[model samples]
Target: MPAESNMSTHSDPQSSETAFLEMRDVVAGYGNTTVLHDINIGVENGQIACLIGPNGSGKSTLMKSIYGFADVKSGTITVNENDITGRSPQENLMAGMSYVLQDASVFPQMTVHENMLMGGYVFDDDSQAARRAEELYDEFPILGDIRNQNAGTLSGGQRRLLELARALMVDPEIMMLDEPSIGLEPRFIEDVFDRIKQLNNLGTTILLVEQNAQKGLSVADRGFVLASGEIKFTGTGTELLNNDEIGRLYLGG
Candidate 1:
């Protein structure tokens, strides 16, 4: 049995001051629609924090708000204690943050190597991008094997792997992945999660939104449950997994 956790309905603002990524009292949405209200969450450095909720629960909106895709009506978002509210996506990427959207993002016409190079477009020197791609290839040898193949020709799993590797070009301090396992085959799902753990082992902090609640919480260091755009439960991953109420309501027990 998993040990119990101090699951709280609301986050403690004072406790999150030192978090690597922190959002406080943030109310965000697209245009005039407010999707999130008084959202408060924190992710520690080198930790895998996951958000799991039902559809339309604003899980994606929360991520979008942090990555500058949604409008923040109030409050602040900080990374490494530096305020980054309202920063553009490009600015966030330059500041050691990378976001992988839920939708398929590979460029069909581009070769695997070319797609990898695109990930490093922010680099001032072309040689630097090449070097980074080589390093990633060493880490993900399968990508190296398919370097010459057009991205459109790759299988679903291959495209997913490419997306993950490409995002590593900058070696981001933190990576935000939304529904990474969605649309993947069972075999590929495990592979994706394994790579996620590997990345964490190599010092990349992760903030994830996954529809597979059990799988997501199983690997997460910390977990948050959002409903109706508000955080309803916060605890260690094991705690959330073991919580009877959580399992009954969210885990379909």
Candidate 2:
């Protein structure tokens, strides 16, 4: 892994002692569609927990609920022990949470700096946001060097890195990443996962939804396998990885 970045704790270690975040029985979907059923998930203050499964397993749907993009019909979503279910994205940001979707989360026409500034939208002062952006850039030097460059021009891997950096502007405690490694080449996939593992090491509780099951589980401290909007298995990465049935079923043997 690259040098570890500063940890992003879900709660200020000096100020609180609570689980960073929690999603209890989250059921969400399109209008009357109800794709996610009784989904329960959590991310500890400084750990990486991943969800992996075949496509159409409500992975993205659950992510949307956590980020307040989709309506969570029945369940509680909390951050630092405060209820956040059904809150808007803006509200979630104010609560010190960040979300990075699989697509279009980055402003194509904006410079990397501009994109990071938007991450700190809750802040009213440009200088403070800029300083936070600079701190993020420092965490990802490859992104820092191109901070002023148009985000649309970056390579796929670079753009993903930019999104991760931008999500850190609030110095978020739990950074929910939806498909963090989507659409990247094999080499870059390793690079991205390495960075994610590094983020976990830095104490950022990451709740990741990934299509690449094998790779996602390899780096996770814990893993869940979702099927048809419900959790079918939950275990440490190694436990799931060693399960012969899981290896053959999801990891493609």
For every model shown, what is its TM-score relative to the native structure?
0.97, 0.88
- Residue 119 in candidate 2, Cα distance off native in Å: 1.6
**lDDT by residue for model 1 over 1-253, one digit each (tens)?**
3325467867733237668889989999999999999999988899999999999999999999999999999999999999999999999999888898999999999999999999999999999999999999999999999999999999888999999999999999999999999999999999999999998998999999999999999999989999999998888888889888888889998
Q: How close is candidate 2 to the true structure, as a TM-score?
A: 0.88
lDDT tens digits, residue span 70-105, model 2: 988898877778888889888777877888888857
Can you list the residue pairs that collide in candidate 2?
Answer: 7-202
Give candidate 1's error at residue 116 in angstroms.
0.4
> RMSD of each candidate?
1.6, 6.9
Clashing pairs in 1: none
Residue 177, model 1, lDDT? 97
